[model samples]
Target: MNIDLRVIGEAFHQFLINIGLTSGQASLIDWIFGALILLVIFIVLAILLIWFERKLAGRVQDRLGPNRVGPFGLIQPIADTLKLFTKEDITPAGADRITFNLAPTLAVFSIVMAFAVIPFADKVIGTDINVGVVYLMAFASVSSMSLLMAGWASNNKYALLGGFRVVAQLMSYEIPMAFAMLLPVLLAGTMRMNGLVEAQGQFFGLGWNIWIMPAAFIIYLTTALAEGERAPFDLLEAESEIVAGYNIEYSGLKFAWFYLAFFMNTWVLSAVATTLFLGGWQGPFVSQVPALGVVYFLGKTIIMFVIFAWIRATFPRLRIDQMMSFCWKVLVPMVLVLFLLTAIILKLGLPTIAVWLLILLSNVAVFVIALWLLGKGLEKSKWASKRLFTPEIPRL
Candidate 1:
């Protein structure tokens, strides 16, 4: 039995060699295959996200979401796709035809480009580019420009307002978001997503980055939701006020493209969170099995999506002023402080327990400061509103 097992192992080794693959070469081939698989997975996930959002929104409002299409509305996305394809394409009479036509395409393109930089798992990355993190941030920003173009070219007031809101909200959130992202980069000591995953893999026991850096994780989650324009930060598409927002003038497949881009954007944001704070695809004993890393990565992404959904269900949208204040005054400063604390801990060569304690203390300090500031702001706002609105009367 031992001799037969040895022979089988030898044959497998020879087979690998015959394919022009050293162990490293075989691994590269596997990575390429995994990327292609992920591409398909992303496409399917986009469709499912549409169904999920609809079902979730329905539940929030106490209604059934698309039950007649298929089993539990499983085929609703298919029906929607077909309807979009067959609908009449309408371009407004005075709209800038070229820019209007190009906007949706740009939106979809930018999102897919951003996905190329995300490392799904340790060995399942698309490319190990030196500037992967920067590349992701850049491409993500391009989607905002697409929104700008779509709104501007449509020549609609509501679209213009929606685009402007997107610019302001996204720009404000990016500062804190970048700082939050920096936490993972500092911990991993690399910009490459694959490198980040590898660093997390070196943890001894229960050593995921999430536990090591809960503040960063919390900040990352909040920023990601804002970046994706999900609830509590979805003021850009305030339905009652904006009348369908930037895509108001869009119809047919053009409208579909906008919705598709939104779904893709959300998925990519969740994937980024999974790759950064959740250790990408690192799981105990899973690396021993070939290709299981990719499995873990997808599972992690799904969990992130569920969290996103949960937040959408629970939170109401913030007012515009409140949203701006929250991002600029609250999240950005907190993330900067966290970054400083993390740097100091790393510099001092502190033990893991010490590092965690420092992080906890920092969080406590931030919480106290924030509460104090909020109370002050509320009192001042009440006084200012009364003064401003209660002007001096001629008779009284």
Candidate 2:
């Protein structure tokens, strides 16, 4: 049960060379194989995610979900995919044909590219590039362009409005998200994904960044909810408001691409959050048995994903203005403050325990203050005023 993945990988690479391939060609094949493995793993996970969400939503609403498709509806996503394949592919008559055709591909592609830098386990990264964090940020921004293309190219008013919202929402949220991301890099002193994970591995994996920088972790998840366009913050595709938003005109497999990309992006965000704050692949015995690291990583990621699903199921969507205000007025300033505090604390040359204790107390203090301020702001809002002070009409 304990497989040495590094040895297997090396053996495969040598086998490719033995089959009359040049060293360069063999290396390219090795990379392609790695990419394919990642793709296959994600595609399978995407199917299960769709099913899990459906079941979760159904149970939340007191109903059985997709029981007719297969045993526990395991085959439902496959059936759905086939149905989408059979549906007619239509391009709106006035659409810019090229951009419309390319947008969905770009959306999915950008998310997939983000996986290139993530470490699933020890020695399990795709490419341990020095600028992996920057690489992830760059590709994530591409989704904005893809959204704009889909909306504008379709020549539809609703799509155009959704596109406008994407620019405003994603760009604004990225400010806080970027600042939140920088906290881990600042603490770890490296931008590599593996480095970030390794930095949290001290003291038998009990030294997670989440313990010392809880505020940043919360800020990152909040901004991630906005960045992924998940529920509550999902103004970009407010179905009641924008009629399915930017991808309204897409049909069949094209629409499926957008849908798949949304869920995949959710997984990616959860995985990144896990790696950064959860001491990814750092469980007891992981160093002794490397394969267990993969299991630990996946378990943590799934827990994070469940948090996302629970929030989606329970919280109502925010109005567009409220979402933007929360990011700029709340998360951005809080992250900036924490970032400054961290820098000053690091420069103080404190002992390890003292540094962690001070940072932990700072995070807790900031979190409580932010919540108190947010509650005060809510109490002052018109809705709260009306609800608290307005006379209730007698029910007939």
Off by over 4 Å in 2: 1-3, 381-396
TM per candidate comes to: 0.84, 0.95
Candidate 2 lDDT, 133-231, residue by residue in tens: 888889888988899999999999999999889778999999998888898899899999999999998887668988879999999999889888898
- State the TM-score for model 1: 0.84
RMSD of candidate 2 to true structure, Å: 2.0
User: Model 1: per-residue lDDT, tens digit, 1-396?
Assistant: 112222443565567778777987765665565556666766788888879878887887789988998899989999988999999999998799999999999988888777777776554455679887888889878888988999899999999999889888888988888888888898778998888777777555345677777777787888888888889889888998898778989999999898888878888888888888777878866556535666788888878887887788789888888788888877887888888877887788788667667766775676577668877877777434644765667985
Q: What does candidate 2 score on TM? A: 0.95
179: Cα error in model 2, Å: 1.0
Q: Deviation in angstroms for 62 in model 2? A: 1.5
Colliding pairs, model 1:
none
